[model samples]
Target: MLSSTPLRWPGQARASVAMAFDLDGPTGAAMLDGSLWGKPEYFTFGGYGPYRALPRLLDMLEAHRTPATFFVPAWVVETWPRQCQAIVERGHEVAYHGYQHESFFTLTLAQQRAVMERSAAIFKRHLGLVASGFRTPSGDWHADTPALLLDCGVTYSSSMRGDDRPYFIDAGDASRRLVEIPGRWELDDYASLAYTRAPDYPAGLDRIASYDQTLDNWCREFDGTYREGLCMTTLLHPKISGKPGRIGVLEEFLVHMHSHADVWFATCNDIARFWAQEYADD
Candidate 1:
């Protein structure tokens, strides 16, 4: 059975839904190096040997004239500072990812705070703009997540999974400095191919229908609550979404979003700032 449905995005205002491309390039390299942290490490799910897919992804975004936010690791900035700086200079946004790409959930509260503080300082020092957003290394955030993020003064974090809409995640605390923006869930290509054993992974373009269905799902969710002005986010890792063959799938989706009125293509910072002003209530 085939079902056709309209696609709606967060805030589905006549305004627009933002398209975010997370540039996770060089750090993928560090992860490839087996990382100083240890084994069972993940550089990429598709296997990361000699296939530098990220540059191609960047080229694709450039071709689309699509601006993105590169949530970069501090180590990457320390190593490839010029490239990180270049991203911002060329109009893309830069946000703090992590210093060592370590999972926040693995760290103690003190360790997490130090990680945030050090990474924020490095991002500001190297790039001139303090990272306004934070993404956990593996989408793994720990129990004290809300307090840690708030204490560090981060504006919004894209690590949560319940919904795609952006919302003021009240930590139910005094330092409520954080907002939780929803991100792609098991929907990521890697999760499907490896974790879920989805057959589409090997079929490539044949999986377009599944991709389309995902987008359709987003639309239905957004349209249902258009008046609520929700925050929606999609996740992309260069290794996963950057394949020459797969990038087009994403590109097609971008075109689809633009063709429809009311979808906004924006940076993470832009979306968060807008949400703060128009969507959030004190």
Candidate 2:
């Protein structure tokens, strides 16, 4: 039954997980001091606060020869088009992170569609890539988002916080274009940030989990997916993962990934395109 999943790569391809970065700049750090979901200082300060470690991050990833996808907000791209271009120029995939970084759950359906359209336009005109993927700001999406995303020409959305495996979403009639690449709540940097501990090293908690017990769950899911032929994904934020102190945990995890040969470390777009081609009739 598992091997029946057309999404699964051929052979023993253990779940090929893509590493991603939200790439919100220092402006988000400043916003931390402001009101966010009734919490002040939410993302206002930290390792990712916009000192622009992209160069360092690039160096680090280069050291490992790793390719990643960067989900960039339209405002961030407008703020740093050069940097955004550099990300593409350096070979990492770019996906939409909304226009304003506002949660879709908070917006009216029209507002959500407006933002989605704006985001797609920005990516296409500026980065010269037609971003077929979407990730909600704060990972919040209403049930109506899929329909609106289809209306906006989005082929897949990555805000799902459940199983790691990707699956086709029946958009009913609004649009059959949308697919779901399940995101994990346990593995995202945001989860670790909110995960309370006395020590409260929000950054370390996520990095630590990447290599520690948290990863066990990811592997279990990966093994299950590969054995049964499923799919999976992991999400990261540059503010958290790109930091020097925390990058070690991510580095360790990548090294661990290297041990597995069958896994396909591919871009989110690659997954979406392949699925559409292979299962369009299904």
Candidate 3:
């Protein structure tokens, strides 16, 4: 469902789309718990994201002539500087995920600030990036996270699932607000695609949705959002969708989306800035 208020897109566009990828390379629970320290297999499994999958995805985006945003952890940038650099070189926005994909809700205010500060510095030093966007590492944030993001110069977040369009999040003061370009779990690749044995993510070992079915669902989602004149932001992961077999699903979905008329494919930063300027009173 969408908000009752009308949302006007730039130019003659009917709806907006933001293709987002989380480049979580060897940085997650496994890395934090030291489980992936000596396990090269496990390490390389996640490593496949930046090492192999990213270049392919970049080329695919370039081929489609589409823009995207990559939410990356600072450690991934530090480990794979050239690969991460290529994301910017290819004309995609690089937003903050976390320092190590840590759970934002589990972190205190001070720890959260520390993570943003450390991450910002790493992005600056390595990629010359001053991130204007963020997606919470764990899909949630602490109470003080919004204000802290403003403090860190982040202008928007694609972490929550409050609405089908762009909205503003007040950071205690009405004068200062952050644009929220919400995304749904249904749009996230990991919910249906990611599979791991040791960590057993999704836990029960029963995961990985059918490619055709997933593509159908993604297209249907785009159709619904487009019909309602809302925004669609995906929670895609390079490690999940960038696999050989699964990349076709993404390609087909993109093709399906591009087939539509007056649909704007934009980066999260552009969407947020437009929302902030257009709906400042809302």
Candidate 4:
């Protein structure tokens, strides 16, 4: 049988909230397949994230005084250097996603290492960022992914859906482990908000959910997680949640979170560091 232990957050806070965004931009399999060669429309759709939505989202986060984490693909960072820098300038964190949202499950150990190395170098060159955190771009990882990430100097990840609290994944070494700040599908905006007409993408255009219900669901999840004193991290996407029509959903959710007392709003890096330090023995 399994048991649950509530984590005591910093400052005796009831719960911890890490607002994370997967800044994927326009890089994906489309780039690999040559299908996105002339689709300015597709490019525009994804470009909306860094070009327009990011500024609004940044301002909104500033208004709430909340720190966030952006898991960016290296390609996106290279393409939108200024916007990516703005995230750091606004007191947020920039973590690694992948080179071009590649699936680690498809890459060999060597390929994975190369990807991390190239991505890390790109981040360093473009933004002077040494990313300590990672979120798997494809929502899954290779069997040896954890070890490779540690080798690349990544200390934590905001992937996986195993638990609501932070845990450690064995990094193939007894002396060190990578911290995992897990997220859930219920907390991801892509699952509820993204829509595409492409037949190959999502198979249909039925992805969008009711905004009011989605907001309610987010609040309810927060309430339950807060009640249990567990960590809550969102798998949000700027392209999905930053739309003018949907930004209010994020705002209302933030307002609801602020209404509760003793809730710690932090970046994923801070939460992971705290967990790793406070629960070093675990």
Query: Which is the leading candidate under TM-score?
Result: 3
After superposition, candidate 3 runs with Cα above 4 Å error: none
In the range 171-282, model 1's lDDT, one tens digit per residue, is 7654464666667653354543222122233345443345565555545544543434444566666566666666666677566555556656678778788767754444
Q: How well is each residue in 233-280 modelled by candidate 4, as lDDT tens digits?
A: 998988889989899999999999999879999999999899888988
Candidate 3 or 2, higher lDDT? 3
TM-score of each: 0.71, 0.79, 0.97, 0.96
Residues 1-282, candidate 2, lDDT per residue (tens digit)? Answer: 333444546454655666777776533323434433343334433224334566667767777777777778887787678778888888888888877577678789988888877877788788898877787767777777787787777788787765556667767663465777767755565654333232243545533443455455545555665565455566777676566766666676677676677777777877777667766666
Q: Candidate 1's error at 251, in angstroms? A: 1.6
- List lDDT for all candidates, in order: 0.62, 0.66, 0.92, 0.89
Q: How close is candidate 1 to the true structure, as a TM-score?
A: 0.71
As for TM-score, the candidate ahead, 1 or 4, is 4
Give the per-residue Cα lDDT of candidate 4 at 217. Answer: 95
- Residue pairs in steric clash, candidate 1? 7-219, 8-219, 16-262, 16-263, 16-264, 17-263, 17-264, 165-231, 166-231
lDDT of 3 by residue, 137-253 (tens): 898887789999999999999999998888888999899899999999989998888888877887885768888889999999999998888899999989889989899999999
Of 1 and 3, the candidate ahead on TM-score is: 3
Task: Give all candidate RMSDs, comma-separated.
Answer: 6.9, 4.5, 1.4, 1.6
Best candidate according to lDDT: 3
